[model samples]
Target: MYYGKIIGGVLGLLVLGPIGLILGLIVGHLFDNGLMQTLKFASPQNIARIKQSFFETTFLLSGYLAKADGHISRQEVDHTEAVIAQMGLNAEQRKRAIELFKRGSAADFQPEPAISAFMEICRGQRQLCQTLLFFLISLALADHKIEAAERQALQRLATGLGFNAAQLEQMLRMAQAQGHFHGSSGFEAQPGTRLEDAYTALGVDPDVDDKTLKRAYRKLMSENHPDKLIARGVPEDMIKLATERSQEIQAAYEMIKKSRE
Candidate 1:
């Protein structure tokens, strides 16, 4: 049996909070089942563990979101494949991601259980949690519009992960902009079409001061930096997502700068 969901479902951890309780249960269960003999969670390995949880769970939830509309569309499949290509996963890693995705797409899959573990891994890093949400939102909007089922599912996930409705709506719109911007590969901008989206993507405003705008730009870039994300335990394959996010941030920043100039 796949122990990922089993530990994710450990009921006791929910009452204990994010750090020791959840991870303790996970490591203990793994050791008890002879999955691993020794466990060391000092910085490096700990970060890797969190990263693995985040990465694997992202794919799992991606599958769930895609299947929310009852059936996964060809568009959704293509989008997922495109992302897999971008991540450049090795054969084994790719297989694992695919399996996780499939598990998430199952009809009986319950998100609440795994989500508990996800929340724990993301306990202190609000930005990281929000960043993960953004990527999931992007996946939801891959087919252009968010279906009713998809929207409802997202609301549950967002609420569980500590995002408000407004935050989810805002990210949904930005992810829509991201789809268009990335689809065009930065070459096809209709005049004035992306103005508002550009600002929203950078979390800034057209009227913002130079310093404020620059600060937002730098902070977003730093947060989504590929190397930083990799160090945080994001798999090498997911670096493409980081790179794309940076490109969008840069594109949005440049558009605003030109308007100001």
Candidate 2:
């Protein structure tokens, strides 16, 4: 049976606590269920609109998340630069991204409008919404310091993006687990990769049955498959991110499989 809902439901519990260990599994679950077959953006114009909105909202909310802790830190700035680099954006795109980021970081910037617009555009597309939430969560945790203010901001963003607090927590955990599984090579475990993180990366409990574990692994892989994401209207730039995420899931599953054997 498909395990996406099972994984997401379990991970949702983590958003209720700090160091959320439940995020990725839920997102993986939501996307792997073939729900995206209903996508309506088949026209070039529609696809372009989705891409533009997705890109703009991403940087805007990323800026909002960065400025959540009162002041934007150098690490956050560097992280944003790294994200831009990974996207390999052209000069015009980079400029627009920078401009949106600056606007979002302004003291009076309101994220509701952008969030609402994105929500409306992606009305039936849970995968796209979750992916955007995933990106913002990554930016929020970039500094490795999730202050109370930042945490609240994250919750707000989650709610604004049509997710509940539990779902936000799940996404947070999944994002954190990615750090453990991804490095310069994109899928290499960092030094001292922990078993706990491996489990978290897959959004499963340590004591999960082998059958369930395999289902969770398959669910995540199917969810993050690049072609699947593209069909769901995820920006092309995010395909690399999704591919790397799949790598992390695979690495995590491998770790679990080895330990069991």
lDDT of 1: 0.76
| Model 1 agreement with the true structure over 1-261: per-residue lDDT tens digits | 446435654644675666646675676576555543223332676777778888888888888989998999888888888888887878998898899999999999988777789777645357667767877887887777888999999998788778989988877776666454454546333455568778877776668899998998899889888777776566666777878878877777777888887
User: lDDT of model 1 at residue 51?
Assistant: 81
Candidate RMSDs in order = 11.2, 13.7
**Global fold similarity of model 2 (TM-score):** 0.81
Error of 1 at 41 (Å): 6.6
User: lDDT of model 1 at residue 188?
Assistant: 32
Q: Which stretches of model 1 miss by more than 4 angstroms?
A: 1-42, 184-192
* Consecutive 10-residue window with the lowest summed lDDT within model 2: 16-25
List lDDT for all candidates, in order: 0.76, 0.81
TM-score of each: 0.78, 0.81
Leading candidate by lDDT: 2
What tens digits encode model 2's per-residue C-alpha lDDT throughout 158-180?
88877998878887887788678
